[model samples]
Target: MSKAAVETISGESLSRIVGAVVGLAGFATAVLAGMTTTNPGSVTLGRALICLVAGVLVGRLLGWGGEIAVKEYLERYRKDHPEPEPPAALVRLKQKRDRHEQIVEEMKKSA
Candidate 1:
């Protein structure tokens, strides 16, 4: 991925990651819940599979929304706190240019 894409956290990657995490959590939860019951068989497995699928779908949606919200918040934050103008290096270069001009003018006057 490009630098900008990596830095901004694309919705696709975020959604997938969130979906996988939520699906795993749901699966684990379902399995644990089933363990408490007297019959931990096909029904438990079915429930776990359903939970995993549902969690992934829901989590993906949530993650996409979260990515958009974060992007918007970052945009607003960047707008509010703008970068400084004439960076330090540029300011130094301008100062050096002014000094060189002054020296050349002084040399011309002396000649």
Candidate 2:
């Protein structure tokens, strides 16, 4: 194994990058809101944390929306350009196997 090779993102990871980005945006908004709402003498730490969490949640949802949209589009595109059907001989073999399975199941139940 070469330890020096550069790693590249796969198509799936590339797709989910949208989600990660959205999460970051959410986190930022949360932190900002938290920072703004605390009193002058109070510890803003709690507020900051609460907002940070909220931000992350928001970002995740946004990212998910994007990912889902992409996935749907890809699925639609693939459906329109499907792979070729399997050979008739292969289909026949599958049908025979299914029939054999049902017979085995019926015999087991009777026994």
Model 2 steric clash pairs: 19-63, 22-59, 23-59, 26-55, 27-55
Q: For residues 5-86, what per-residue lDDT tens digits would candidate 1 score against the true structure?
A: 2132454467678878998899999988997897658989999999999999998887777767767777888889998788
Query: Taking the candidates one at a time, how many backbone clashes does each contain?
Result: 0, 5
Model 2 Cα lDDT, one tens digit per residue, 3-56? 222222654443245445555565566556656775542345555455556655
Error of 2 at 95 (Å): 1.4
**TM-score, structure 2 vs. true:** 0.45
Per-model TM-score, in order, reads 0.66, 0.45
Best by TM-score: 1
CA lDDT for candidate 2:
0.62
Q: Any residue pairs clashing in model 1, and if so which? A: none
